[model samples]
Target: MGLSNWPDICLGSLTPLLPEDFPIDEDHEFKPDNFYFLKGCVHFKNTAQILDMTNKVKKSRWRDFSQSFLRDVDNAAKKADEEQEKPKYEIKSCGEMMRTIKTMVDGQKGEKICELSMTFVSFDSSMVRFPDKEHSRHPLEICPVEAGSENKHECFVRHSIPYFWDMSSQFGTLYKCLNQKRVKIASICAFGFGKDAVLAIEGDQLDDVCALSTCIILLNGRDAMDH
Candidate 1:
């Protein structure tokens, strides 16, 4: 997509914890100004076309939003049971689904600034990740919807990060305050593609989020093998 067609994105603010709600050193004096707040954001380079897909879907998650491809699979599964009355349910394989995602983003980028894809294992899903040459999958334990539902449903993106099996597990979550409420909107994690290092992010709106810091490191497996 051209710069003119790109959408405008803004940073979401981080929420502060109350003194009583958070643990603090009782002996030391609490400096409210220094300790009470944090702010962050992320921006894609002007020359690059960023396509980030993070897996934020819950296995037990209620079907909330109906996007294009998913709607097809969902509609077929809900049809009548009779053979003649039943709708033809051609299961959309996971690979096909990923291809669809790839196509949509790739179309927008006329030139290859960064044709990177990051996929992650969905939370609470029983599906296994077979080895793939270009995607990373991690199985997250099933978590209750209520475990952390204070955030708005719109605050997270449902796509999975496409990182292959060779990546590191250094990942963490990002929190922000939206409309007076505290919510987690993004997550950062690492993947090892062969000996190459890759970074993955999970969030509702990536462009608007701030980046405190970013560093990419490439490791030499030959040295480790010698040890």
Candidate 2:
């Protein structure tokens, strides 16, 4: 999805493996959620410097760098061709079937960072869950990878839902995900329009935000499609 002020972050299968007439499991008793259990990639335009930032960089410096980049994008009018030429990063992964799941994002320089991964912890679905909806008994566990590291689990975000009294208008509301120390990494506010949502991410948590937002967008898209 393209953000007006930031570089567009798109999620899709590089190529379709299923046939055009593949059956959609819309009538399943459990009802389908937005999470995907197939293979695909998360694409985004990024610079080498931003991707090279070390975890040791002070939070203030990281925030400044991220803000500076956003300012540059907002102030400059990028030509269509120039914008198309920006370096693209892709995180590829395989879902289910395989006992192991590992995904990484890589830039033109060929460096890699694990975007997210889920290994076979247990046969029970509730054992694995998303960070945003921690209160619910979700079946999948998505662990976030620390900056500059592949397959390293640093922390997970917790998602809480609105109270019953507020569910009418505020249904599907999402607070930002927090680290183990209760630090807010990113904030997402989704309105009733499904795909029409806003994401506010901090400078130091760009990578984490990117990974988290991918899942959110997929879930949003699923809702839009069903409705």
Candidate 3:
């Protein structure tokens, strides 16, 4: 989707989050002032950074080195300690179709923050659960605005009113719905490709956890398709 083809309302929604002079297109990257992506690590200004992926090669190297010197009993204890020290957020596959985003607390899986499910013929589904008295579950339905379009990058994320809804363009912008109104929240440039793939998040209108988790799920889905 090109900038000229974007609906006026969509453009209006992005004004507050993106600079007026910034170009919106697949080739033009979105760079938010506060958020940045670095080697699978998400860094927020003055906030805690999250590691998106654990290094498997580093783990293997450590195991090989330890086996050459450390005893089995000592090696096993060190491995357990390292696992507990790892980041809390994790994305685990439940089956061929479903995946869950979990947060660890006190060395145990704490909350299932979000769940994503794949579909054979339609857009995928994502459910965001709130840990509250009502235990609310919000469903985000992904639908393509242009029918039969091969650009897998463009889609609309529909959810309950006055809560969460999103419209994603091939240009990488994710607009959020607020009280039936749309506003830009995040953007992903060069999605699912190379080391240059970047994600930029802006403002505090939407929950950060939901925003990040959803972006990861979308990017992972695209990566899976490419592979």
Candidate 4:
């Protein structure tokens, strides 16, 4: 569909993912809910420094012997180390069929957040798994929904079995099955094509895992179509 129509679809289909017990501000009527916008292509860099003892020893002889010179080098090295140590998300390809998404837990330690694997029988369908969950082995299926013949923008999000089967008639409503309960989590609307595209996610259900998963799925789908 056109980019202009997505906001209405998103807002209309939006449902609270949070539990009823979650605290809410009764007096703040004007405050807008927080949301995240993701680009089609994301780039991440690690600035960790590698200290060379040989270079340090050689430079020590010719470089300034003052304490100020030593302090400057120490600070630069420390800054670089800190930047590298910070936890961030990463995506890695596992052969041809599987792509894994992970995040840095403690310095240099990696934890699997989720995995997206293409189905052998149906190229259009893919499965996602959360390794940390109790039922990590069970994979959730995700597929693209057709949005009119003229509209090129594709919308893909996780849905319950009933919702998936009844999508044609119930396209306006979306639900996510979590822990055997149907919950309305997040809605992701992607605009444009390929690397230039952008993704807008509903504020209420937005989280690191949800945002990253949606971005990976959409980008991968685009790449598959290109081939």
Candidate 5:
């Protein structure tokens, strides 16, 4: 927020006080911003003070609104950290996961193609990160049991992989109250591939490895907002 007095919230800064609430998803992410996030995470250090302040403010209260937004930000950051922990050998994208998979699929190394099955554990969204502000990051943990797990193996099962995404990347510009940039195609596409699980096998090995990927290409938050 422009107001300096308000708390700063980021999407990647929380040090989890407990094990993540959601598990992994079809793609193996640590969804932390889900409703179950707070259920699984230890309360913020200043719980009493946070609650007291929340109670004092009304919906119209800018401080309250900003506070609530910051709390969500903190939660989103924590959730993002949780999502970043796991990786599926089949999944591919930029640097980390991409490199890990590269190590696995580059047949020159002759890695074993073991049967891999992932259950839908959790999937959630981290809040938008604005360049102008050095807000603290937090993640929101989402359990697959609650909604779409965004996985093929554990889409419904409790053992699925987890997935995390930055809301700012997907919907930064459209979120007016946040006053961020417009829908960023590059960031959105990066996240699109990021949450995706790519199964790369040596030539003619497709039949040997029976794997699938599922990521619904739904519109950004604005789509949800319109409805």
Candidate 6:
């Protein structure tokens, strides 16, 4: 939530974070034809105002912001001492996550690549009652899949979140989680009027009902997914 350039609240706190729109899922999958993937590096920095130090650093604004986090033993001790009194200028600008993400997105370097699958499905029939299943026999649901049934839904990129909140001094693709082994996951699909029904197989139940305010956006195909 640091609000310097983007968030604009407190400026960069040097706290590594997921991309603003991370863990996001879209109703449609990214067209495999498009095939867009982002891979990059996570440069750590010791300072926050990367823009200000660009000239002194002799590197891109992003690099200064990320690589400024220092690893020198002496630098670490000094930073710990400054924790007693929080200063507006003195922030431990550790910039690994963002830097790595940027690099990955920029097609440079990464331990993992971020990719999304998008697709569009249209109803079999042009006009019909939404989700009523009044016409269950027909494929014309509210939204139509371009192809046929199966694989009609959209899915988005999903990955387990690393717990960097702790300053345990862990390093490199290292974060403890209940399920830390799973690298990437794809989830979230389907969109429609409040009353749309997805066919469940063999006694499985599928129903999603959100509050009026929340469903309002969903009904209109407005994505308000949280990262």
For this target, which candidate reaches the highest lDDT against the unseen true structure? 3
Residue 108 lDDT (model 5): 29
The TM-score ranking, best first, is 3, 4, 2, 1, 5, 6
Local accuracy of candidate 1 as per-residue lDDT tens digits, 1-227: 11233122211224312212222223432111100001011111111112221222222322222243233323332332222332111111112222111111122333211122212222221121213322212321111121133321112111221111111223333333333333333333322222211122232233221111111101111112221
Can you write out model 3's per-residue Cα lDDT over 72-110, one digit (the tens) per residue? 323433454477644344444433433333331211354
Number of clashing pairs, model 5?
48
Off by over 4 Å in 2: 1-82, 98-102, 118-183, 189-199, 205-227
Candidate 2 lDDT over residue span 1-227, tens digit each = 11124221111224311111122223322211111111122121121111222221233422322555333332321331245432233444444542323334444554454334333332111112234432232322332222233222222222221100001132222222222112233333342223223233444333343434344323222122223
Candidate 4 error regions (>4 Å): 1-87, 95-108, 118-123, 134-138, 147-203, 222-227
Residue pairs clashing in model 3 are none
**Candidate 2 TM-score, true structure as reference:** 0.30
What C-alpha lDDT values do all the predictions have?
Answer: 0.21, 0.27, 0.38, 0.34, 0.21, 0.19
Give per-residue CA lDDT, model 6, range 1-227, as digits (tens): 11223321211124423322233333322211100000000111222110111112222222211333212212333443465422112112222321110111111221222111111112221111123332122221122222243332211111222211111121111111122222211111121222211110111111111111111112222121111
- RMSD, one per candidate, in order: 19.2, 17.7, 12.8, 15.9, 22.3, 24.0
2 against 6, candidate with superior TM-score:
2
Off by over 4 Å in 3: 1-88, 97-110, 120-137, 150-171, 177-182, 190-197
Candidate 5, RMSD to the unseen true structure:
22.3
CA shift at 41, candidate 1, in angstroms? 17
- 1 against 6, candidate with superior lDDT: 1
Residue-wise C-alpha lDDT for candidate 5, range 1-227, written one tens digit per residue = 21234233322224321112432222322111111111111111111000111222232422212446445534543454576522122221122221111111212233333211222212332122112212112221221222332321111110121223223232211000111211111111221123221111122211111211111112211122222
- Which one is best on TM-score? 3
